[model samples]
Target: VLAQNLVIQSSSEIRKPGDSVKMSCKTSGFTFTDEYIHWIQQVPGKEIKWIGRINPWDGGTVYSSSMKERFTMTTDNSITTAHLQIDRLRGEDSATYYCARDTMSNQGYLPYKNIPKQ
Candidate 1:
């Protein structure tokens, strides 16, 4: 099985739609760039939500299908931080944002054996 971790990303600013926003996730269980970082948003009265995510090693981003084209995601491996920027202001942009990263070990990550198993 793969290993797992829990990282809490904290931010000091609440960004508007047109303003740029960034957050950082410091891993406590493993190395920094070995995994992926994901961003989420939950409304005032809703369950877990998905907004976007970024990969630190290559600075890759994946946004939700329903999100507008304005949302942007980026990451800096050197600092172990992820950034979420949304351009153009809109009332709907007001939300509680969350940032998360994939643990080095996952629940189903298993290695193969060199030989057949009995």
Candidate 2:
């Protein structure tokens, strides 16, 4: 149900090496108002990998070990949106991005399921 909401939501895009990019991951299917929106990177002809995680409910950011000081996180409780911004984007930043709602409770929180190649 939550996935349906995200699929229909139109997200904005960001330009490389420019100002910060803001893409929101809104949720409203379970107890997600106080949850984590985990961001990931999907490279062409490759698999998706963890990028960073943002606790929209509390404005906390947990970046990958190698990704520290590369990204930032914010949230708008009124809009139920979690936004991620990467500074000074590089070639490595050029990839498809996804956000998953994760929280202590597993309700309405389905792990990111990728499409298998045929």
Candidate 3:
């Protein structure tokens, strides 16, 4: 699927320890089910972690080894949106998060990139 003029929007959140954080990725300029949406986390001074991805076409998802235990992935194709929710916020979760569209080829990702942390 060609994703010309694709745009994704998500907001920052403020949460206390042990709270849950639900982040959304609203998209435009493409059919939501035409591609997969992946979430990633970049903790300050650390490498990026792949949270997971959802197949809007079938509502199937895959999470990273570390994140699968505590994170959830969902989508609402009707709204052209995908979501990532962290079950328990810890100090380690203090970092920027991002929603990306898998370019669906060997060319690699062409995602929106960064969003503020919770």
lDDT: which candidate is best? Answer: 3
TM-score of 1: 0.65
Q: Write the per-residue lDDT of candidate 1 for residues 1-118, one digit (tens) a residue.
A: 2246545455445544455544455445555567676666655566645676677787777778876487787766666666666566455655566655564322222211111111
Question: Which lDDT tens digits does candidate 3 get at residues 1-118?
Answer: 2356355556557787788878777877767898988887877789777788899999999889889987999998998888888877777777777777776433433343343444
TM-score of each: 0.65, 0.69, 0.82
lDDT tens readout by residue for model 2, 27-86:
665555656777776767887667777776667777888667777767777877666667
Runs in model 2 lying further than 4 Å from the true structure:
1-19, 103-118
Clash count, candidate 1: 1
lDDT of each candidate versus the true structure: 0.56, 0.61, 0.74
Report the Cα RMSD per candidate: 12.9, 5.7, 3.4
lDDT of 2 at 16: 45
- Where in model 3 is the C-alpha error above 4 Å? 1-3, 104-118
Question: Which lDDT value does model 3 have at 9?
Answer: 53
Q: Candidate 2, which ten residues in sequence have the lowest lDDT sum? A: 109-118
